[model samples]
Target: MDTPILRNNFKSEEYQINMGPQHPATHGVLRLLLTIDGEIIKKVEPDLGYIHRSIEKMCERDSYQQIVHLTDRMDYLSSHINNEAVCLTVENALQLEVPERVKVIRTIIAELTRIASHTLWWGVMGMDVGALTTYFYGFRDRELINDIFEETCGARLTMNYNIPGGLMFDIHPNFVNRTKEFIAHFKTKLPEYDLLLSGNIIFQKRMQGIGILSKEDAISYGASGPVGRASGYSCDVRIHHPYSNYDNVKFNEILKTEGDTLARYQVRILEMWESLSIIEQLIDNIPEGDFFAKTNVVIKLPAGEYYQKVETARGELGVYINSTGTKNPYRMKFRSPGFSNLSLLNHIAVGGKIGDLVATMATLDLVIPDIDR
Candidate 1:
C-alpha cells in the first residue's frame, strides 16, 4: 500500500476585536471595531455616536449667547477656543467690532487654552504609551493654567467665557502676573518633558516611521492643526486666516514633514513653545478699553449665512451659521477637526499592530465629544 498521504489544511483566519466604548487607550467613549489577522491590523472601523448630544440641533433652539455655552461641552479641552469660534461667527454676521482690549485678551487667553490642552494631551499620550510619569507631570503644569482660568472666567474646564459680542467679563486683576508666572514655570518644566519622554529610545522606536500619513493624504482627509502640519500641510488657521489680533503677533506655525507618529508628537511639543511666545507678546500689551462690544439684548443675524474658523488644540474648528433674521440660528453646524482627523485612522493604521494603533490614535489627540457633536 502506498504510504498514506499526509496533508495539513490548517489556515489562519481574520478575527474581529473591539478596542473600546470603555477602553482606557481609546481616551473616551469611542468604539473601534478592528479586523485583525493575529497581531496585524487588517482594518479599523470607528463606531461613533456613543457621546453624541445633537449639539447642532440644540443651537436652533437656543439664543446666540446660549449657544456659546453649549459649544464648551463639545471640545471641552479647547472650550475657550470653541467659544471664541462661535463668538467670531456671530460677530462677523452682525458686522461688529469688539474693543481692542477684548481682541488682545482673547488672543492671550486662547494661547493659554492651547497650552493647557496640549499639556493634558502630552500627559495622557505618554500614559497611553506606558509613560505613567508623564500623566502626573502634565496635569501638574496644566493646573496652573486652570487656576488662571478660574480667576478670570470662574470656571476651569468648561469655561463659557466668550459671548456673541466679546468676552463675558474682563480678565482678573492678577491675570497678567499669574500668566507670566505660568510661562516662567512651564519653560523650566517643558525641557524636562523632552528629557523624560521625547528622548526615550523605546519611544523613538515606537513612534518614528509609524503611521506615515503623506501630505497629499492629510489634505485629502481634511486634516488640520498639528496633524496636518506634521504632514507638511500649512493649515494653521491662526496664520492662514488671522483673527482676534493674531495678525498683529509674530510666531512660527510649527511644521514637520515626516508625517509619522513621532512627527505628530513633536509638532505639539513645539507648538507649546509657540503658544508661550504668543502669550508673552500680548500679555503685557493688553490695551486699555472695554472688554466687550455692546449688542442688542437678543442677537438676530441678517438673513444670510456666516462662517468662522479657529484653531483649537486638536485642530481647526469651523462654525457655520444659517440665519433667517431670528434670535436663534436657522441652522448651525460645526466642522470639528477631531471628526476629520479620525477619518484618516484606517488609512494609516492598516498593517500595524494593535499597540501601534494605540500610539497612532494618541497622536491624533481625538476628543470624542468633539467628533460626535
Candidate 2:
C-alpha cells in the first residue's frame, strides 16, 4: 500500500513506524507501532509486558504482610500508596480498625508518596519534551522527600511501611521536624519549577492541544489521577470516597477540562501543592495512639466477601477478598490503577504525532506489573 498522506492533524492514513519495545523516549519497556505522515501520527498501538513480574501469582503463596512488599514493587514510584492499598483492603477484610494516629500516619505517607510520584512525572514530562533541567529540578526536591522516607521507613522507593491494620511502626519522633523541613524546602522550590518547565515556551508548544483525551473518553476508559481530573471528571476518590483520614484533612482536587497532555501536566503540578497543604494540617493533629492494630498471625475470616477501596497516587485501588474462614484468602483481586490508565492509550494515541503518543503515554505513567498480573 502506498503511504497515505495524513494532514498535520494526524487524522489521515500514514506509513507505519515501529518506535520501540526498547526506545530511549519510552522511559520503560514500551513498544509503539506508530503510523505516521511526516512528524504526525495517524495511529498507535502500545505493546506492553516488557516488565511483567507475575505479581498476582506471587501473592497467592505469600503471607498477607509479605504481599504488601509485592505491591510496593508494582508501582515502584508510588510504593507507599501501593502498600496502603493492600493494607487497607486486608484490614477491612479482617475487620481491623486502625487508631486515629495510625490513620493519620497512613494519610501522611500516602500524600508524601503522591508528591513523590508527581515529582517523578514532572521530571519525566520535561525529559520527554526535550528539557533536561526541569527533570533535575524535580528530583532535587524529591531527594529530600526520599531522605525523609529512608530515615523512617528504612527504604525510599519500596518502603512497604503499611501493614494490615496500620503502619509497621509509629512515626519516628523526628518525623514531624523532617516532614516540616522538607515541606518548607520543597515549597520554596515549587515556584522555580513553574518558572522552569510549566511556564516554558517549548513545553507549551509541545503539550498544548496535543494527545487530547476528551472528558467522556477519559471517564469511560477509567482514567484516574491527573488524567481523569484533567478531563474535568471531579472523580478523585479522596473527595468522593474518603479513605483513612483523608476525610479529616481538607483539600481541593485539582482539575482541568482540557483533557490534553498540557491539562494532565498542569493538574499534577497543581496537585503537588494541595498534597503539601494536606500534610501541613495532619502533621500537628496526628493523635497519639497505637501504630499497628494487633492481628492473629494466622488470619481467619468468616466465609464472606469484603471489598475496600483507597485513593492511590495513581487512582482508585480496590482489593476484593473472598474468605472461607481459613488461614489464607480463598481468592483475592486487585483493581489496579495502572491497568485502567494504560488500557486507554490506544484511544488517545490514534491521531497524534509519534512524539505526541510518547508524551501522552508518559502522562499515563504506567507501571506494567499491575496490568500483567
Candidate 3:
C-alpha cells in the first residue's frame, strides 16, 4: 500500500502555535505548544529542557561544600532560600544545631528573598498583561532588597549565603538599618501597587473569574506556594513542616477560595504583607551569637538518606541527598515547586483565552531553571 488518507470525523477550526522557548510571557525559556480556536485555548503542551544544567548530576561529583552553590542556579529568584534548603538538609543529617542568631538571620533573609522575587514577578506579570507602569514600580522596590542582599552576601541574585551548618558570613553592619528603611518605604508603596494594577478595571476584567483551578485539582497537581494557597489548598511547607524560625513567627498563610487568576494575584499580594510582618518582627531582635556554626572542612554524611524542605517564593523546595559515606552525595535530587505548578497549566489553560493563560502562569511565578533542573 502506498498510503492511506484517513478522514477526520470532525474538522476543527483550531490551530497550533508555539508560545516560547524564548517568549517573555512564558517566563524564562519555556516552550508552550498551544492549540487554539478563535483565541480560545484547547490544549497546552510545555516543551522544557532548553536550559537544563543537570544540577542533580553535578551534585554527585562536587564536594558537600561545593554543592551548595549549584542550588543557586535552579531558582535564582529564590537563590538564598535554595541555598538554605541544602544547608538545612546537611545540618539535619549531621545533627548540627545552628545558633539562634543564624536561624533568625536565615529566616529574615528568606523573607527578603520572597519579597524580591514577588516584586519582580509583579512587574513581569503586569507587563505580560499590558500594564507597563507596574514594571517600573516593581523593580524600583526590588532594587532596595537587592542592595541589602549585596551588602550582606556580596552578590545580588545568586547569593550562596547559606552554607551547610549556618551562614557563610555574618550580616553586614548596615544590613539591619537598610532593611528597616526598605520596609518603611515599601509599606507606603505597596498600596500603590494595588491602585496601579489591582484596582484597574481593565485588569480586573481580564483576570477575575478566568483560568479557574479548583482546590481538588490544585492538590492533585501537587501545586504549592501561592498557587495552591489561592486554590484553598493549605500546602504551605512553612506551616506544615516548620524549619528554622518559621515556627516562632506569627504570620497568616494567605488563602483564596476562588481559584482564579485574580485569586492567585491576591494571594501573592497578601503574602508580601505577611513577609513584611515577618521581617519587622525579627529585624531588630536578631540574637547575638556566632553566625556560622563549627563544621569540619571535610564533611561526609553517614551512609543514609536525608531530606529537608523550605518554603520558597514559588513554593516548597526539598533537597534530598543519598550519602554513601562520601564527601560527595551518592545521589542528589531537588523537588522544585515550579515543576508541579507548571503541570496544572494545560489543565487550567484549556477553554480560556491566551491572555488568561498568561495571567494564570504569572500567578504561578514559574522560574524555568527550577523545572529543568
TM-scores of the models, in the given order? 0.98, 0.93, 0.96
Clashing pairs in 3: 20-31
* lDDT, candidate 1, 1-373, per-residue tens: 3344332333578999999999999999999999999999999999999999999999999999999999999999999999999999999999999999988988999999999999999999999999999999999999999999999999999999998888898889999999999999999999999999999999999899989999999999999989999999999999999999999999999999999999999999999999999999998888998989899999999999999999999999999999999899999999999999999999999999999999999999999999998
TM-score order of candidates, top first = 1, 3, 2
Better of 1 and 2 by lDDT: 1
For residues 1-373, write the lDDT of model 3, one tens digit per residue: 2233334544558899999988888888999999999899999999999999999999999998899999999999999999999999999999999999999999999999999999999999999888899899999999999999999999999899999888988999999999999999999999999999999898988898888999999999999999999999998998899999999999998989999998999899989999999999999899999988899999999999999989999998989999999899999999999999999999998998887888888888999999998
lDDT of 2: 0.82
Name the regions of candidate 2 deviating beyond 4 angstroms: 1-15
State the lDDT at 189 in candidate 2: 90
Q: Is candidate 1 or candidate 3 better by lDDT?
A: 1
Best-first order by lDDT: 1, 3, 2
Candidates' C-alpha lDDT: 0.95, 0.82, 0.93
The candidate 1 region of ten consecutive residues with least summed lDDT is: 1-10
lDDT of 1: 0.95
Q: Candidate 1: RMSD over Cα atoms?
A: 1.9
How well does candidate 3 match the true structure in TM-score terms? 0.96
